[model samples]
Target: MEFNFADRMSDLKGSAIREIFKVIAQPDIISFAGGVPSPDTYPVDALNEISQRLLVGNAAAYLNYGVTNGYPPLIEILKERLTKQGVVKDSDEMMITTGGQQGIDLAAKSILNKGDGLVCENPSFIGALNSFRTYEAELFGVTLQNDGLDVDEFKKTIKENKNIKIAYIIPTFQNPGGVTTSLEKRKKILEICKANGIIIIEDNPYGELRFKGEDVPTIKSLDTDGDTVIYVGSLSKVLSPGMRIGFVVANSKIIGKMEILKQVNDVHTNQFAQALAYEWLKNYDFEEHLEKARLLYKHKCELMLKTMDETFPEFVTYTRPEGGLFILCTINKEGIDSAEVVKACIDKKVAFVPGFTFMVDMTKTSNMFRLNYSTMSDEKIVEGIKILAGVLKTL
Candidate 1:
């Protein structure tokens, strides 16, 4: 018998980052593929303490069915924290998600139907790009500059593209680009999106890991009324991704729609995990933990950048991100294929993601690739780059 599938499934493929893991799963291969928070920063002792008490004392709360939005205590704590940071408004509502990824998925679900126009940075996060594609949205890519999304290109794209239902951005410490959007640009982007009636999905998973720069006010915070922007935040970077704790801050209308979608998505995020995040944030010195993470990442990122500068060929240019886990590399010369470079490096037991997978249009090849610094050790980072450099010299 033949099987039927949805139209969206025809051309869609699994994430390149995840698929790369399957190919390079051997222990000897030094991988710079995942954007996971370092395990060294996990508050194991605190979580162990919280988990022990919660299981013995409050098993029902976690095990039993709960509201689709989230655990109430965790929600309240998040509301308070974000409000203090100027991200949450009195008129806005919030919902907890499985992770920041689901928040992006729900945003796509809330605003997009098939073939609706969607605007995002040229090389945005692969997860978000794929999520939007699942709805068969017509994606418009805005070129990225060192500061963030190019404002002129953004304005041009939005003006040229009609039927754009949603605009997505990662203003602070962006994923693959590893660049922060300037406040001037953020204001401009926000104003333009609001004027155009495009809902903004601000995916900020790495906002808390600012190891080298001053805080840039989030676009959601600038949206004082909280209607135009959907702020998607996660504890995956500073805390544990395994906890699957993420939240969305937006107006009641958007929140109401997402709440229903969440009900259908997974009913809600894990209850015990939510409780653990709540306890960690409210009781423990989370700021202290975050400080340690920042310092750790700072050292690793600097070491990686320095290694790249010294070992990599002069034709290779890359971003020096103040924060975030990635450093995006571009080969300056022409006719040198990105895939070939990746294959060569992989052959040498070193791996990083090729840049095309992160683009809105994946049909074209890219000369860029992304290197991650947070997951590997100092020795591995240096060793990986030396191996990569040797491969590039042959090109």
Candidate 2:
């Protein structure tokens, strides 16, 4: 029998990160391929205790169906947290989704029509790019500088391209590149978007992981009109990915539409998980736990960078992220494809994702690649860096 799939399936490819995970699952392999939290930092004990309490005392509420918008207590708590940061004022402005990825998908679905334009960083998050692609969005890539998105180029792109619906950004501690946008740039980008009537989709899954610098205000926080920015956040980086709890903060009108759309998607997010997340937030000392995680990531990042400095060729350069799970390595040697480097590293039982996979056009080659340091130990990081340096040297 022949099967017909939707046209959207034609260009959608499997996640490069997940594909790499298969090869690196071997115990002997030292993988810097996944942007995952360290197992050592998971609050297993706290969650276990929370789970028992929920089962014993709150099983009726937790095990039953939840509202499409999410668990109410969780919503109130999250709203208060974001309010303190000046992102959103009212609880109705938010909707809890399964994770940040779903929030991205919902935001794109709500605003984008087929062939609408979406301006994004050149090397943006693959998941977000793919989500927009599902809606047949025409992606316009703007250069991403060390400080953040290039405001001048962004303005030029918007002026040249018609019908650009939104500007999708991961302003703070961006994935793959791990670069944070400066406060001045953030304001400028917001101004540009507002001037052009383009919505700003702010995906910030890693902001809470900052270990070095002071926290920059979110683009949503900067929205004086309150309707221009849709902020997406997750507990994946701070809490547990398996629990799958994330939320979207937007204007009430936008959030109401998303809530309706969500009803047709999954009916609602998991009830048990939402209950557990709410309980965890209410009871646990999350700040202390966050500090510990930040220190751990900081130490690992330092170790990785120090090793690369000593081992990698002088021609090679990498980003110095204040905080995030990744570092983008640009090998200056001409004709060196990062894909080849990844393949060779796998043979040596070490892994890092090639940069091209994150690009809007995967066929385009780059001498760049991304490495993650959060999941590996000090010794494993040293070993992986040594192996990767040898691979780069040979190329």
Candidate 3:
């Protein structure tokens, strides 16, 4: 029997990396396919203590359904943090989203209509790509350079295209591409988008994990106008992804609409998780936890880069990220299919996502693949790369 679905659901499918989890469930897969943080970094002990206390002291609030805007205490705490970052202002309002991903989806839903124009990096975050697609937004992909999104092409695209409503970008340690947009480019992109009246959705889940290079201010921080950018951030990297603690800072008008959409969507984010996240942030040494995670990831990234340099063929050039979970490798030689390459690695008990999974058009060839360094052990990372390099050599 055939089942008909809505137009928005017509082309949508499960996430590729998520599907990889099912296949790599075996203990020996040495998987590098997920954009996940290392389990070692979770403050499990502190969370366990917090959970017990919350259940004992405020069990009613923890179990009861809360408002669509999220738990008030958590929202206030997150607002304070964003304020210090200089991204949120009195004119701006915020909401605590289920995760950074939800913030991206909600922001897109608030402003985009069917057939509206959308812009993104050529190889952007797969999750954001799929979210924008759900709105049936016509997406324009700008090629990403080593430093960031191609600014010149961005200006050209905006000038040529009409009805382009939003520009979604992961400026720092970008997913799949592992590139950070430079400071100058950030200002220029903001100027161009503001001039053209395009909303900028800045997804920043990995900002606090920077292990190298100088920190680049977010586009929202640079936007003194305060109406041009929607800054989305998540504590998943530093704290826990399971809690789904994420926040969005946008103009009060946009946030008000998004809050209503949130009311209809899930009614609210999980109240218990919000309480847990709030207690932890207010009482714990979050900065200490963050510093430790940063150091661990820094070591892991350096190790992965070193091993790739030694094992992979020179033709397979990859990004050396300042900080992030991924390093995207592009096969310089022609006629190579990345899908086939991924399969070969799987056969060797090593797995990674094909680069096409993150593209605006998956049918188009990029000859690139992504490797992760944050979830696996030092030994496994070394072994996986050695095995993967062997497969690439035979190509």
Best by lDDT: 2
TM-score for each predicted model, relative to the true structure: 0.98, 0.98, 0.98
For candidate 2, lDDT tens digit of each residue in 333-379?
87888998899889999988998888878778888899999999899
Better of 1 and 2 by lDDT: 2
Clashes of 3: 0
lDDT of 1: 0.90
- 287: Cα error in model 1, Å: 0.4
TM-score of 3: 0.98
**Per-residue alpha-carbon lDDT of candidate 1 for residues 1-395, written as tens digits (9 for 90 to 100):** 78899999876889888888986689999999889898899999999998998899979978888888998999999899889999998789989999999999998998999989999998999899989889999999999889989899888888888888798999888889899999999999999998998999999999888998689999999998538899999998889988999999998888999999998889989988998999889889988998899999999999999998899898999999988888999998888668788988888899899988999989888999999999898999999989999888878
Model 2: how far residue 312 lies from native, Å:
0.6
* Residue 365 lDDT (model 3): 71
- What is candidate 2's CA lDDT for residue 354? 91
What's the C-alpha lDDT at position 164 in model 1? 89
**Model 2 clash tally, residue pairs:** 0
CA RMSD, predictions in order: 1.1, 1.1, 1.0
Report the lDDT tens digits of candidate 3 across residue range 1-395. Answer: 78877899876777888888897898889989988789998888988999999999979978998988889999898889889989898899889998998999999999999999999898888888889889998889999899888899999998899979999989999998888999999999999999898999999999888899999999999998649999999988778888888889999999999999899888898899999999999999888988888899999999999999999998899999998778999999999989899998898899999988888887777699999899999999999999999999999
Candidate ranking under lDDT, highest first, comes to 2, 1, 3
The clash count for each model shown is 0, 0, 0
